[model samples]
Target: MTKVTDVVLNLIKIKGQKKEEAANTNERPPAKKQSPGELRLHKDIAELNLPKNTKVTFPNGKDDLMNIEVTLRPDEGYYVGGIFVFSFHVPHAYPHEPSKVRFITHPNIDLEGNVCLNILREDWKPVLNINTIIYGLNLLFIQPNHEDPLNHDAAVVLRDDPQKFQRDVQAAMLGGYVGQVYFPRCK
Candidate 1:
């Protein structure tokens, strides 16, 4: 009986050793590799020289390099003196793929926060940097394009009646009603 017990214990020990070895040998952990886009975003941030009244913050905190917030105060245009905030999400595929940007203002923002900027979407290329995007956003406010618009209504007004569109933009910036929605005073 004593010999049998010793044999049983040895068998158990051997089985446990086999299981441990199998786990160590068979498992391959997932690799962590930063994409080209992420590399570009990092480079862009490091090289950034922001303009006055233009601030950048990482809402997800510094530890998180993927998300960021950019606030703009245009010196000229209908959006002049207005504070507009934008959010940028850098996916793992970034630099190679354009960063996903969103406007996080009041609910008064168009249904899609669609910043109908050519540089941001159609004209985007690896050569473009954050500085370019910032400048483009400022341009959008200074000269809201009627021909190519994210907000159709705003575009229509801008195309059909430039004066009324300007008035509506001013009204919205001042925290008034352009239609049924009330915008917060950003100026």
Candidate 2:
């Protein structure tokens, strides 16, 4: 009985010593598991083939993939020659939830950069990806939708006088004042 007790005590001491050695080692803790959203986002980004005159960038560097910046320079349309920059924040629940997009002020976008795109709102689905959103944003510049707008005043002008809307867009792009609002030059 005494020999058996000594053997049990020695085994316990060995187990404790192993645990202490493991804790003292410089080995890093296990890497954090990537969420479903992150995995999907990574896949989408890897497969991106951006549209003409459009480019996607990572303002926070490649390490931070959640935050993205897209630059669009339309080759034709009322927004032609104008440089528009949009910031996109992909949620951890991305694809399940649309990425939050903020863009420069436009007829389809508010002064505070709130975009009015259906896919980014009610029409979003898990099947949609970053490429789709970029394409949609590019389309907005090609055809500024006055029917569904976040900037109502701009929309009204676009709906009522297409020519004046064009002029106003040009003026706004040149850092001129459009009514009471002043837009910085982006051309």
Candidate 3:
């Protein structure tokens, strides 16, 4: 409503005319620039419903909420005793635009295994929150969705046989080779 702010906003739009980012583009924004999703993430983490075996920590510190690492230990599955780490890269649009995920270690799971899940892919919806995503990830270890896997080879082995998949998982977790790829010990 003020003349000065209106002028500044016009200038920002002219410089960077992203329609989606228009609302947050203000004058004297803040000392620390956080995304709209940042506040949402803070609330989500505060009221987090993670299992005892799973924990999410900000490696960069609590100040940086955009990035977080989730450590999961499934007690009753192929990945039991295995420590799997995944980083959730929360975008400014976040719930609107999905956060990226990268697995730290595994055999049935791949390093670039973000696109494997339906939730991260075609089935993503704004209604889904961090907790939902975390649960989906936990489900992966209990039952790796081989049908829609990012690693085609791993998926194939997991689908074709259960015993071989278990052997491969054990080998990979112990810092051995599954196929040609070697995995570092995550135990």
Using Cα atoms with residue i matched to residue i, what is each candidate's TM-score against the true structure?
A: 0.74, 0.84, 0.79
TM-score, predicted candidate 1 vs. hidden true structure? 0.74
User: What lDDT score is found at residue 71 in candidate 1?
Assistant: 95
Candidate 1 lDDT for residue 142: 72
Quantify all predictions' global Cα lDDT against the true fold.
0.74, 0.92, 0.79
Q: What's model 2's TM-score?
A: 0.84
lDDT tens digits, residues 31-93, model 3? Answer: 686677887887788888998789888999988888899999898789999998888898889
Backbone clashes in candidate 3 total 0
Ranking by TM-score: 2, 3, 1
Q: 1-187, model 1: which lDDT tens digit per residue? A: 9999999999999999998888789786544576676677788999988888689899988767788888999888667788998887877766656677776222223545656667767788878878777777767777777777667777787788888877887898888778876677887
Off by over 4 Å in 2: 1-30
Give lDDT tens digits, candidate 2, residues 1-187.
Answer: 9999999999999999998788679577756788898899999999999987998999999978999999999999899999999999999998899999997668889989999999999999999999999999989998999999999999999999999999998999999799989899999
Distance from true position, residue 110, model 1, in Å? 3.3
Report, for all candidates in order, the number of backbone clashes. 3, 0, 0
The residue-level lDDT of candidate 2 at 173 comes to: 91
